[model samples]
Target: MEPSVYREKWSALKNAPGNEDALSQLARQIAFSFVDRYYQDGLYRAEYIDLLCEMATSFSDTQFNNKASSALFEIIVEELCDDYEEMPVEIYSRVMSQVISYCRDVPEGVALDRRLTDFGISTFDDLYNRANLVHSRRYTYGAGRPPEKIILLSRVTIGADVAILSVMIQRFMKMFPDAEIVIIGNAKLEGIFGGNPRIQMRRLSYARGGGLFERFSSWHAALDILQTEMPPETEQNVLLVDPDSRISQLGVLPFTHSDNYLFFNSRKCDESAKHSCMAELANSWMHDVFGAGDFCHPTIWVPSGVRLRARRITESLRAAGCRRIIAVNFGFGTNPRKRLSDDFEIELLREILKDPRTVVLLDRGFGRNELLRSASLIADIGNRGFHASVACFEDSQYPRTSHGIIGIECAIGEVAALIAECDEFIGYDSACQHIAAAAQTPTLTIFAGSNNMDFIRRWSACGDTQCKIVHVNTLADPGHVDTDEVIARIMEERSGKAPGAVEPAHKIPEIKPPRRTGKQAKKAVDS
Candidate 1:
């Protein structure tokens, strides 16, 4: 689980030194932010509460005032129980098990822990049974020919790389022809051969909608779906596929296997193990799950119809006198804080428009409203010293005929197709970038606001050598990045010029954040 506000502040407090007061204040502010969100979300999100627990623990450990932190925590928890439904008992217990250890006063901690446990909250095991018990119809597979069944448990959602997960499932079925496969995970996940005839899909009940026992029952039901779906073949291969989960404790997966491929999926991996990207981790763990498999980057399947539409769209843009078609996704939908600042974007726009033959197709997806807020935000480039044609999605010649920054959300299919048709792609860490890379489009990803550079490398368009990732952690300001540098990098990519060749007319941005003079250097979390 990731903390939204205190992530950087927490690391800073742990590091100790300059801005101690500022960091502590920020920690408190972050804590309250969680509390506000928790109340706003109607306390259904146990995850947010878990973040609060962590904040309390951090602040109570001399990082902040223990007495004040304890008071706030007590009030928050008490108010939480008063307002929320049944409350997330198991989640609280999981958190409180350590919360007590973090408390400065053992007597006070003991009293608090006992009172909390008395809520009759179901334990983790009980929750698991209640949630996933339905899916376990027959534990063992009956004797038969080579394993005839494969069950996979995952949590992939619709907005995520459903295509990659889909392809993986399809590949698995192809890899083992005899095994009948069933993928049980997120309900919203699509492209699962709903009618395409690729693989089977079943929805795992979400734990969020229910109370204590009910929640775990939902979780157990998800697991049970895996169990009951298993074919009772002589060779049955049942596997759980949550890379982030600690499945070794369940004792269901085998410790070893005769087949390397089957063995990889049946074994457990240390969650603490680090990898560059979740894909890399998934791939590695997948290798652990299924033995040696062909390495493939994530990609969405573009139907022939979509391809033809994209071509028409591109051709129309070309005929309209927009020469170089560059695609841009500002990733503001996922997290606006991470979006490229107005200054940087404006600077980049000016530089790109400077090329007479170049016309950028900005992918202002459905969430563009969240980024632009109003029409006034987008400045007229002509007045900004560059004559560039801009069009909103509503324009008759919008995405098809006119090429400019369309500040409106577009359908996923259209976005993918447009990206496929473009000459080059520019985006932040987003699905657009991923899709573009998967399509083998030349992409320049500017990642400056992530918690760590590892995430950048991990998610970097694997298998695409043409992809250029520029990691900038500008210290002076993060939200406002070095647009000039990004522009230079873009030109370099197009001209095949060596990096940093463009002479900067102004100060070059720092690759890393400004170093603080504190004793220990604390880095922020990767967002």
Candidate 2:
């Protein structure tokens, strides 16, 4: 053998025993390079991260596979939660995509043993657990193609519900280009979920009267529609997404006549920072559970009429010396954790009043709570010496549905139009923020301190550079936010000021785990 051949053999022997470190370091370098080059916008991050993670999985050996995977994991964790509890959605997608890819290659019935560590937290266990979950589940499509048609069962109820479906539907359309799409949801969704060429909407009739008999009749009608719409059971690859899965709970899942199903119940996701984001959870539940990998952002169809009216309305506001209209929707009834105290809302509005070039447009009519909050807010307007004249309204339906009590598509349409015209939208952890995202407007989403960082990262509207999140941290007393500083940042953000120039009050609070004696680390890793 040549002298070079001997040296190569010796080096391979020397390095093969402990080369994961070098490989990991190289992977880290590559990850940093990727973020540096491609981190221009939110959508860009998603594209590039997807590409890299997909490419990384192709290398199944040590030099590229394990170390690169480990590096990608750490970089993902750092980018997502190093400075804050969550990274942007694109980054989160990249990490999750990498996890799926890794799971794809992991041996069956095997626990992954990468032993990689980021921030002294080894994510091998987490990735392994998630990977195992991904691997073990059986999707109906099996090794063949996806179904010819996807039937999403009827359960559309509110604005947030529409917002969640927007992106997922967009992604599904892209993923299964030729696949027929059918939405059997509330009749109101016809407007909110209209305008897609591929989508065929079947109006779902539900009980409007809040009566047991009416609801019972409505449910029967829905069942009849479902039975009529679904393809034969022998038909291959039909996906039925009963998001919020109440039908399955009612034992009517068999009626849908499709084996592939994804069901979600909204419990155990609030209170602590330990949940996956509401958005991501929705998508991931469908993805991991139902084997649908496509994920997209909320979509809103801005009708020309609505757009024209919004522009005219905004122009009128500008004509009336309303400097920058700051939209506020601080009331959320989904959970108390998402609801801000009236005092906090008032304090922030009072702070905003100090700025002369700014005007606050409160959301007064979305929910019943909002009506009360708005009344209180208007009552407190005198405290800041701002008159009722600042609250601008024409014949616009935007004011009518500001409280969002009745979530009809017409109301959502008007609100979407109005939000599209606003400079900034401020809302709590609810669907209004997602609507702002659909409008491509800048939003300041004040997140409640939920222990599930995954939930926050996935669900919160961060896929756009314009969306900013300030989260509450609770070590023991748990919920504390500097509302005043949040207002200042909101103002600076609205005025197009650089972030670092402003005094920082927003934080991604450190989450303290409940004091349990055993397996805190394991539980955290699992969580």
Could you tell me how far off, in angstroms, the CA of residue 435 lies in candidate 2 after the best superposition? 1.5
Q: Give the CA lDDT, 0 to 100, for residue 405 in model 1.
A: 44
Please report the candidate that would top TM-score against the real structure.
1
Q: Distance from true position, residue 2, model 2, in Å?
A: 82
- Per-model C-alpha lDDT, please? 0.47, 0.51
Model 1 CA lDDT for position 525? 9
**For model 1, what is the C-alpha lDDT against the true structure?**
0.47
* lDDT by residue for model 2 (214-333), tens: 233444455566566664553446666655422222212133323465444332233332444444445544454446464544566644565666667666657656667666776564
What is candidate 2's TM-score against the reference? Answer: 0.55
Minimum summed lDDT over a 10-residue window in model 2 is located at 518-527
lDDT of 1 at 238: 51
Which ranges of candidate 2 are over 4 A from the true structure?
A: 1-136, 140-148, 154-163, 177-179, 195-198, 203-221, 231-238, 250-252, 258-295, 302-304, 321-323, 389-410, 449-455, 473-527
